[model samples]
Target: MIIELKSLDEIDPCEFAYYANDPNINTYLRNSFPAPYTLDHALSFITHSLQHHALDFAIVVDGKCVGCVGVTFQKDIFLKNAEIGYWLNSQYWGKGIMSQVIKMLCSYLFSNYTIHKICADVFAENKASCIVLEKNGFIQEGYRREHIYKDGCYHDLILYALWRNSDEY
Candidate 1:
């Protein structure tokens, strides 16, 4: 299948909401990603992405927007770092789409920005995500026990990091 990264503005909010409405997709994601995602939520998110000129991009598969990958830039003394995040439609899982998407986004970030490190915080139970990060040369740097509160319960968090010098990147 063809996979590409496209600007969020190029995606239809209805399509985005349709794929993101699945509760299963939000299990490991931050609470900010709403359950039963609506078209309005997609519009708001796309607007914010456009306004900030953010590094966010739509994960396009076979010309259809299937998901997104982006980074949150750090500031102050941490200005050289960015926290990466991503999600894919469950239908696309295990097909290696996310691993490729992460690599593409990381390469773009490294080449276009002055950031030296890309990091990710994952719920400890999300083995698939951790594996994807590892495939992209992200090393687990820390593990915070019960650091995430989701769905009314605490979950462990795994911190992974990749440096600009990583040969794979």
Candidate 2:
């Protein structure tokens, strides 16, 4: 399937919200994504993402948005690095769409941004996400025990990172 990453305006927010708000889709995500997500939440997210100049995009496949991904820069000691986050509609999982979109986005970040490293955190139970990161060349840095609380339980997180080097980028 063809993949395209575009600005939030290029997508229909209602359609995106419908897929994203599904409990099945949000299960693996952070607690910030509320259950029974509303249009207001989607609008707020779109507005915030735009205003923050976040490198966010609607992951489109065959002309329909199937997911979302973004890279957020960190300042201070992490000034040279950026954190990556992504989520796909449950219906589209296992289709390799996210992998393709992530690879393209990572290439764009390395080529365009001043950042030297890209990092991500995945809940330890999210094995599929870890696989995607590994397949894209991110090294498993370490695991954070009970780092986040979600759904009434503490979850361990696995940190993964990839550095920009002439041979890799």
Candidate 3:
């Protein structure tokens, strides 16, 4: 599957609403990405991205928006840090697309911005996501036990990072 990145405008809001509403896909992501995702939610997301100039891109695969990937450049003392976040449509899980997406996005971020490292947090039970980060040369940084309270329960969060100037990465 040839995957490409584009702005959210290329995606049909209805299709995006349909895909983003999947509980399976939203499971590991932040609670802000509500399930039962609606067109209003999609519009809100698009509006926020446009308004804030967020570095977010829609993952287009086989001509459909399968996911979104983005990085948040921190502020103040954390200004040199960029945090990455992503979620794929459940149907595309085992195809190795997101790993490539992460790699491409990481390279783009490092080249375009002044940053010390890019980091991501993965829910402990999400071993697949952890593997993806590891495969992309992101080293495990810390383990926050019962760090996330989502879906009515607490979950451990694993911190993983990749340095911009590291030779090993």
Candidate 4:
């Protein structure tokens, strides 16, 4: 599978909106992404992504987008770190595709950007995500209780990180 960084215009916003709108897909995501997501929301998100200095890409497989992954750089004391975010279509779950994409992105970021640490947050109930992080050598840093209120209840968030100079597992 080949991974490439793409601009918003390079992707189909409608397809992305449909994937995000799926209830099962948004269940573990942050509150900023509303359920029943629409094309307008996706358009807005694309606009924001383009404006920001973040590295965002549509995860393409066999020339079709199955998901997206991005690195959002934080300011101030977190300047040397980037928060990674990603999502895949439910149909592609358990296929190890995301693991490959994430590993590729992490390597690319370390080489191309000034980021020293890559961080990610997984919902406490999402064991699959936790496994993925572990498989990629991301160490569990901490857990924040009731950090995010999603799907009508507060959810704990597990923080994980991988350093650029760490040994590859």
Return the lDDT, model 3, position 138: 94
Pairwise lDDT winner, candidates 3 and 4: 3
Model 2: residues >4 Å from true position, as ranges? none
TM of each candidate vs. truth:
0.97, 0.95, 0.95, 0.90
**Best-fitting candidate, measured by TM-score?**
1
State which candidate, 1 or 4, has the greater lDDT. 1
lDDT by residue (2-32, candidate 4, tens digit) is 6455566688998878776677777788777
User: How does each model score on lDDT?
Assistant: 0.91, 0.86, 0.89, 0.83
Positional deviation of 12 in candidate 2, in angstroms? Answer: 1.0
Worst 10 residues of 1 by lDDT: 15-24
**Runs in model 3 lying further than 4 Å from the true structure:** none
Query: Candidate 1 lDDT, tens digit per residue, 1-169?
Result: 9999999988888998888888779999988999889999999999999999887988999988889888899999999999988989898899999999988888889989999999999999999999999999999999999999988999999999999998965
Sort every candidate by lDDT, greatest first: 1, 3, 2, 4
Candidate 3 residue-wise lDDT, 1-169, digit = tens: 7799998777887777777888788788887888888889999998899789999999989889878898899999999999999988898899999889998898888888889899999999998899999989999999999999987999999999999877643
Q: For residue 38, what is the lDDT in candidate 4?
A: 89
What would the per-residue lDDT of candidate 2 be over residues 19-69, giving only the tens digit for each residue?
777777766787787678777888888889888777889988888877799
